[model samples]
Target chain A: MAPKSKEKPKAPTPQPPPAIEDLFASLHRNIDKSDYEKAVKDADQVLSIAPNDEDAIRCKVVALIKDDKIDDALSVIQSSRNLPIDLGFQKAYCLYRQNKLEEASACLRGRERDPETLLLEAQILYRQGNAAACADVYQKLQKSGIETAEVNLVASLVSAGKSSQVQKALEAW
Target chain B: FPPAFQSIPRNPIVLDLAYNCITFPDIENRMKKTRKGLISRFWG
Candidate 1:
């Protein structure tokens, strides 16, 4: 009689945590270098595993912005607002990018006084050729002692007749 | 004075830096560290 063969258990497939982490790391690198397409690809891979990752969503939005797809970025950010309050500023930024000045201002209105938001509003006004209004807002922000990079840049714009550059700078932001 | 300038509403810039979520020095430091980690791994 033949001896009964012992059955062996098959090994479980390993989960892909390390690979996901590597993908995020690569995405972060691409973002730092302003390589939007590669960053978007890496973020997509991470999102495949963790579909609702906040950082991944942010990376994808940034890539969309870098690609000059402002409307798409706005949509992504608007959808992300359901996640958390910290994402509110990002949503406002998307609105700004889409040239939805009123909506962007509304998103930021009555929030705690954010210097960046103020500067962003001023930039939007400048883009609309409301130079005096933009300057007034910039002066108010300056008087409030909120000396952010955005504030400085806006101040320069107000003084330099570079209103056209405001939109470009906001995009870079 | 132009009518636009005359009608320019004065929106007071609220001064509450504490409540504003502007990136502070500590946050900047953390971001730098994270950037460095990513750069070291990928760009190095």
Candidate 2:
């Protein structure tokens, strides 16, 4: 008969939390799976090590928005080390999504020159039923000599000024 | 909606509903602002 081994079996070691790169990979995986709350937690872990990381911060905001925690998202940016004003687009978006049209409209008030802010403002104005104002934003974007699919679409909506067209265009995007 | 997302009342095939909790059944409910903003920022 063979002798039994005297060595005891080793227990599995507890693994540390994933490295930042692995955490980001997990973040995208969670997002792809539409487990947004889990994605938020992953983003939080990423932010814990790199508090001012733009990608991590943006990921957190996006996950919060996806998880329908728009208010918490706004607070997340506000409480971050980054300046809240720098995230006007995100704040405006949260308000816009929450149907606080007036607040959304006001959030991008001073950023009219920024192309991103211009597009977001145009959308907010359109939702507020201020087509003329929305058209003005499109025109300004055109005059700025910046061109893109979004600008072209915004221009088309400006020309049509139809609510149904606006809805369709926004939806198609 | 969260409750509906969590679990349906009096549903037998509860396991089938498990997928709904982690997946977006409504595209319209996806955060357009964040999605669009992120894409625009990426390509803009």
Candidate 3:
């Protein structure tokens, strides 16, 4: 009898692509863990399946921002259309980092009172030599229960030439 | 500003605030919503 032929090894079954939900979960986890490079890559994968996925777009942009790819983040925001979520604050932040102060201030129009917005606004004011206005914004933040603003308020007062107010603010801090 | 703060720039202070306060839109929360259906016009 002829020896039985050795059976051919079966080819491995290709694994199915990951579900969008799974990809999204990973992206969120990466962002939460501050692993922004991985988050950006995961977001890009999600975007490939759903090109207009706003969640993916926003996550990618924010991850880029966190990763210090500010220009890329801003470009993505600019190019995307009809985003469900408003990324104005993030855009303003990118502009501020690029030293485009006036543009950053403009991007934050109509959202001046938001604590995040106020913080960015204060930074811009401080950079622009409007320390008094910056101090006022920091004071507002402090009144709103932001304890860290106390230190910033003292700094702004010093820059604004308010030595007496600085002493008071410092002591309070 | 104290001697220490005087040397530090606005960059660091606001960096902390931005990271703490500005959170990314949650993926699960946004995904749970049903997608809006396209509107169709009917001819009488």
Candidate 4:
């Protein structure tokens, strides 16, 4: 019988790489906990595994935005194309934050009727000093059953120097 | 809405609302406070 030799323990099979879902879950957990930096790192890990993962890209951009890294967020946004999800609203929001009102407005060209898009557009209009246009956009949102639009609508009217018509506008609305 | 963004509301806090009144951190004051905290952390 062969002398029992100390056999080198079999190298542990390399642990399978973490599931993408698991990584995304951790990323979302970090986001929920408001640990945006960690969330960004987690998102980067996910992106490393699946470079075109739309959800991962969105999470990273959102994490950067939350972290006040708007320039970085915009860079990621501008670099990606053919994204599975539309990030126009997010792009417009970043532009709006940067005070690029015209560029922000351009982003909403086809999405003007989306409630959130309309709200952002109205805000851009307000910033552009086109209070009348802002008020008009808000009125359209109000007509679309967006209750939050009412206050903004009144504010826009006031901004447009139509404070006296507040009551009339409310009644008509 | 982003937490960094604050809407400037007129008077009663509803009308004349200004979207995204972006405020910058007072970096000089912040740096002083950070330095004081670090010094205290190590030397206190």
- RMSD vs true structure, all candidates: 12.7, 16.2, 11.6, 15.0
lDDT of 1 at A79: 71
* lDDT digits (tens) for residues B1-44 of candidate 2: 44554553331110111112222222222222334566457765
Which candidate, 1 or 2, has the higher lDDT? 2
- TM-score winner: 3
Number of clashes recorded per candidate: 0, 0, 0, 0
Judged by DockQ, which candidate is best?
A: 3
Candidate 1, DockQ to 2 decimals?
0.04
lDDT of 4 by residue, A113-145 (tens): 766777787788888988899888877766677
Q: DockQ for each of the predicted structures, in order?
A: 0.04, 0.02, 0.19, 0.06
State the lDDT at A40 in candidate 1.
Answer: 79
Ranking by DockQ: 3, 4, 1, 2
Worst 10 residues of 3 chain A by lDDT: A6-15
lDDT of 3: 0.78
Candidates in descending TM-score order: 3, 4, 1, 2
Candidates sorted by lDDT, best first = 3, 4, 2, 1
TM for candidate 2 is 0.53
Across residues A55-87, which tens digit of lDDT does each residue of candidate 3 receive?
888888888987989999999989884666688
- Candidate 1, after superposition: displacement of residue A15 in Å? 9.2
Compute each candidate's TM-score over C-alphas. Answer: 0.56, 0.53, 0.75, 0.69
Which pairs in model 1 have colliding backbones? none
Which pairs clash in the backbone of model 2?
Answer: none
Chain B global fold similarity (TM-score) for predicted model 3 against the true chain B: 0.22
Better of 2 and 3 by DockQ: 3
Per-residue lDDT tens digits for candidate 2, residues A57-123, read 7778777877879899889868874543356677777787777989988887777456667766766
